[model samples]
Target: MLRPEIARSWWRSEMSGLSPEAPNLRVEPDAVDRRSRLAAAAEPVLAELAEQLGDDGFCVLFTDRESRIVDMPIGAGQLRDRLEGLGVVAGGVFLEETTGTNSIATAHELRRGVAVHGEEHYLEPFKRFSCYGHPIIHPVTRRLVGVLDITCDTGNDSPLLAPLIARAARDIEERLLQSTRRAEQRMLAAFQAAAAGRSRPVLVLGEGVVLANPSAVELLDPVDHIRLRELAVGIVHRGIGSPPPHTVRSVELASGREVSVRFQAVAPGAEGVLFEFDKPDGTGATARIVGSARRPGVRTTEPVPGMPVYVGGEPGTGRTRTVQSLVDGGRTRIVTLEASEVAVHGETAWLADLESTADDQPALLVVEDVQLLPDTCAVRLRRLIERPGLWIALTGAPLAELTGQGAALAAACPAHIDLPTLRERTEELPELVRAMLDSLGAGDRLRFTPAALAALAGHPWPGNLSELNAVVRAVAGHRSVGDITPWDLPEGYRISPRRRSMTPLERAEHDAIAAALRECGGNKLHAAKRLGISRTTLYNRMRTLQITT
Candidate 1:
């Protein structure tokens, strides 16, 4: 066996001439500890090593810092018995100078692997055992952490064992690093969710909450939100914990409240804490309604005053409220038309849809289910949009077949808006509920249970905002208490049954349109810009695709 002093000299040689100021010369104690823990937990790796070396009369063992054997491969029973007979025990530490064996001693001394075959062991009892071993390092920080050893009967010693053992150790380290990275990513995603209005409010304490995103400020009190330092201090003080290092506490909020606070240690000297809070119930109603208001022919911006704005969305997506918000109860001569039934009027009667000249006052012409219009009516209606004083807004479900109709309207006015699905705008649901409750005069008294919010969030709102609103209204009307629980939701609203007719292609197109509209905030003109087409062309495609606005 190599001398312990010689191995130490070799390790010193590896670190020779390293300047303390060098960026790469940093040391991490926690990384070393984590690697050690990983090595202790590596059951699969140990099993693999056993399979590869057992037939050759070899057994694999993992050791902790003090050299105590913490783990052994399952198939190494006989070898383990032999080692125990040779004075190796679970709590007994093995090292070079003490045991006079190359495997453990050389590994510790050199901070790497070593092999001692047959007679190389100074101790006669170990002479029959040939061993190969290597030090395992932390994959991320590259710090030596633990040792892996493979031992076999003296007759089984071979040249290949040393390198094989080293490679196995490296693989374990890599896995450890990968696991660490994935965990960090998950934590970061959770933090971001809180920062955005999408998740419970969260306050990050380390490094002043790192308010890198716009929504991070929303977590703080209105006055405190702008000051990063103040926000951090508040989180540190009000956070559920006793103090910086030993604090651990949890508090349950009123129903509908969502918040998560965490204190995580990134590294030995780098730690961060996070505090998150979800909005009170009903705060997201307007945003949800707006999200669902995107329809192919809807106009986001009012190009002219007193123009009827049309909105199309799935059955429940907010269509009416959004339009009302735009009108702001103005006396702009509003005319509403629903496509539930179509009346065959004269060609000249189509002119009635336009702003009348009785007082020359501009009119807002809101048309719903433009898809239901007969071809002739659609064409004539398209002609009326050409009149300079008329403002027309149209909304409908997937109407790709109405591309020609859309093209005609596009020729008159190119602007259009497409709303997002309820699923896409789930982040805004809580706020929407709050807004709706307040509008219904339940602002101070209304609240939702955690289960209710979770159900709402998980549901794929087929009808969009309209459905959400109806459910909320129903719950509020039926419930006697302030809290609305998931049980209070309309029957089957949370469950989506299997439907066989929906083809994959149709789903893909719907998803694509929904995604595009979300990215463009339901602006048809912007969505058209992204699709590399004119507003008119987009309308035609929407018609062809049977996509409602």
Candidate 2:
């Protein structure tokens, strides 16, 4: 009998225009470079299990949530010519629509273990294979990380496969929990050493972690924390052996207190970097290693009293934080506008609210993602820019992109501040990492070891600070008790093929179009409709991409 979950997934696939016409499997070679948390957590468990299973012509596969195989399978005979020929290999998408009512896709969708045997598959070609799948969910977050599968040829299918797969998934989950517990213990131990004295603030550093003392936490704002962590993570990324060009940093907190700090890999009984702070009373200090890029747009000598300030940068490069830093909290109230968000009431109606700000009030109009604003919103913003009494601070992509949209936007704000990408001034990463750790809720407890820096620095940081922050948070969650090492880092980061090389959206579009054509018998018109695009657009795309079909 077909399970309800299986039946529904099959029905949904058919409804979505999936065909059993053997769509050339969407194989993402890029995934090969990605580090799979599931694979790592499942490894030791599977290795021991594989030994016990004893080469029973069965294979175990691990995949990301999307069902793209992530690792080499365990068990099974060495020869995999039959599986490879059927596109049942690493990087291939074995979703129900592509390969039919299979265990991997069904389990991924349902977030449970499922068994699909032989003739139950919707695709005829897949009927020769039997697969049982279990969803691997993160133990702490209870998030569905990926799917694990046990597959065999029809004659090798056994009733015991489901239970075995379930056991493996459980073991992975337990391992995840154990690692988290270990991280907490290690973090607390390091944090205590760093926070011994309340006289100065110190960032508790560990392998792949940057944590803050309560004093340090109070001293820096959220944005400062971000910058600090970026620097720390940068050090980790650059490798422990690579020291910063210089160590001392003299920074004025938003509170107007100027403090001198020393950044160096302090020699200790244990491993961790420490940022020891001191009063800048001419007693102890060194020239801070400043970033190379000048803040041409930001007025550092004096605050911009009333004039409009324009800030621009790529996503996750800290444009918002930069703009927020410029705000004079004592004088003006910060009113943020997400210009990119199209409200249900429409942009025109949304713009009308900006007019509500009277000239009498001292309000700073802050706009985020200005590059994504509609032309109508741009016109409205232009009108606001002309208001003499109105003070505005806006963030965008680049000056060129802003000007390309229209001159009104380009002319309104003449001074543009472009934030530096991570690749440009990587030397500042250690400091940034310090700030980032301080900003995170759990960061006060965690620290990064010297060796851990290499693991964090592996990627080119195409996503900039945004990606770095996420990776730091994830690594903190994944690591067990210890001074972090390269092994503690995500495998994806370690063997990264360079994610900055391609966008996921572009990859998804290319895969979808190619799959649509295969499913629709290479008919342009049919494929276009299936892809929800017009035939002319489809033809143009095909020609542009040099797709023969």
Report the number of the highest-TM-score candidate: 2
* Candidate 2: tens digits of C-alpha lDDT, residues 327-437: 655454777777656555678666766666434454677877776677877777877787878888778775655564444565577556667666454434445565676
Q: After superposition, how far is residue 471 of candidate 1 from its true place, in Å?
A: 0.8
Judge candidate 2 at residue 40 and give its lDDT. 57
Off by over 4 Å in 2: 15-17, 33-37, 96-100, 189-211, 215-549
For each candidate, what is the lDDT? Answer: 0.55, 0.64
What ranges in model 1 sit over 4 Å off?
1-262, 265-302, 306-312, 343-362, 398-402, 491-549
Q: What lDDT score goes with residue 126 in model 1?
A: 69
TM-score, every prediction: 0.39, 0.45
RMSD of 2: 12.6
